[model samples]
Target: MILTGSRLEVMHFVGEKVEGYMKEFLKPVETYWQPADLLPDPTQENFLEEVKLLRESARELSYDYMAVLIGDTITEEALPTYESWLMEVEGVNQADYDQGWSKWVRAWTAEENRHGDLLNKFLYLSGRVNMRAMEQSTQYLISDGFDIGTGRDPYRNFVYTSFQELATNISHRRTATLAKQAGCPQLSKICGVIASDEMRHAKAYSAFIREVFAVDPSEMMLAFEDMMRKKIVMPAHFLRETGTKIGETFSHFSDAAQRLGVYTTIDYIEIMESLLNEWQIETVTDLNDAGQRARDYLVALPARLRRIADRTRIPTLEYPFSWIA
Candidate 1:
């Protein structure tokens, strides 16, 4: 859908502050942690011993845990799709390389690049993952892309990202806790740092939406409500394994995640509620009649989702994921 004049105007308005947001939300390259910092170094003479211990710890991880980890890795590895999608947003055109929004996207991608790298290398050293099959799924996800209902509107896209980044933070944080409990301190630390990055990114996206709300509360409110109405889709929903049709692997992956409590339907509701409270949806004033209705729907949505969440059951049965060795 074509953006309204007001939406386009607000997008440019928000884009102008991209530099300030980048500095506030992102870290300097020199000071940031690299994947190599957390992994066993090949040049070190003790690398072999470290790998042996890593593999031993990885063996102790449950099947469900491994499956969820692999799925998370695949989604993170599909950074190309995400960057391309964001670059195509209303005012964040990548072709305009000089724009601050484009600069922010590139810098954000730089930080995110290490997540998949760190996790994949850890998995490889752990020797508990089917590397080829996992690689295939990642490739498939990047190729298939996804339709997240955001279109090119910056308002809807930011709202989606705000929810998504927070969701990922929760997932990774939970995985970190689980990893530590399962005797993999190193892996736990890896997830911990990545989760931290996700939270910072979440804050940045949330800030963008808040800025838009300040200028265009009515449109912003409507966009957020529209997104929640459609539901935010995880990019992993497009995941596929070898010889399987698109999205077949997602059901099994999601089940494994649910079974493991890595990411759950309840978590979805909670994230939505968090966004609602953080954005002060109920307090947004001066909205048009339609915008007011959208705000009402958004405010009440969490409780509605909670009722559904309470009634829904996660399957006790586990589906075999090809990504696990």
Candidate 2:
């Protein structure tokens, strides 16, 4: 459990190795992907046939993108925290500890590769962004990179993915919107379907955190607060770095998500409250002063949500979180 100094060194090395493996994994797959514009127009109802064609053509690229996403996030965001977690785990001396964490890392990576390949193959075979500026955007974003949190470890890891899954869902949904707006019915349908898959992934992580809360209430709350306070950005920047407007970019996506009936304000609150109540974090038997403060904050979260709802006009407009005053 407790990682001595020497064990920490091993973790750092493992982290480095994992990062290298991620880079290696990304190489062959990304090559086939073209920028967004070159894809076929969905305006033609005949485009459905094209989409069907892509279902076969784009599968590998879609899989690879998902792989890269998982690897990049883990390497850039989660690995350092795990390195810290070598210290957090309860019993094993890290130096003597077998490479158990790496196994978790690999499994996680395997699950991630699926999304990218699915999306990329679809985009390329469809000939979506073959244009110049769009192609440049892709390069710029990936080079700039995006991240979720700092040395927060598995806790931060959970938080990052919780938000990420939703964020990615929104992106997929918006891509659908763009396709629809561009008269591409086929692309819209494909994106809508893919977005649903993303929503499921996000929900899985959210549920996992809820389970985590049941076991370690205080730690969960601390992690929750940390997640909220820290910046949560879109991972697309990993492939397409635009710049300061990212905050605006996320806002636009959030607005789209609300309009689409994907995730709503209540969804966010429900996820948070479910974890809090399941853990009975607010009612912990041993309440240190800091923990007590956190509990107070947790108790007030609903009222905070109420104010946000009021400001956003979610209730007034009969729309969810739509009334940001």
TM-score winner among the candidates?
A: 1
User: What C-alpha lDDT, on a 0 to 100 scale, does residue 152 get in candidate 2?
Assistant: 31
Tens-place lDDT digits, model 2, residues 11-110: 3433434434434332233542322343455677777786666554433233222222222222223223333443444322345334444433443443
Off by over 4 Å in 2: 1-98, 127-135, 166-217, 230-251, 263-266, 277-284, 313-325
**Candidate 1 residue-wise lDDT, 46-137, digit = tens:** 99999999998888899899999999999999999999998988878788888898999999998999999999999998988889999999
State every prediction's TM-score relative to the real structure.
0.97, 0.52
Worst 10 residues of 1 by lDDT: 1-10
Give residue 166's error in model 2 in angstroms: 5.5
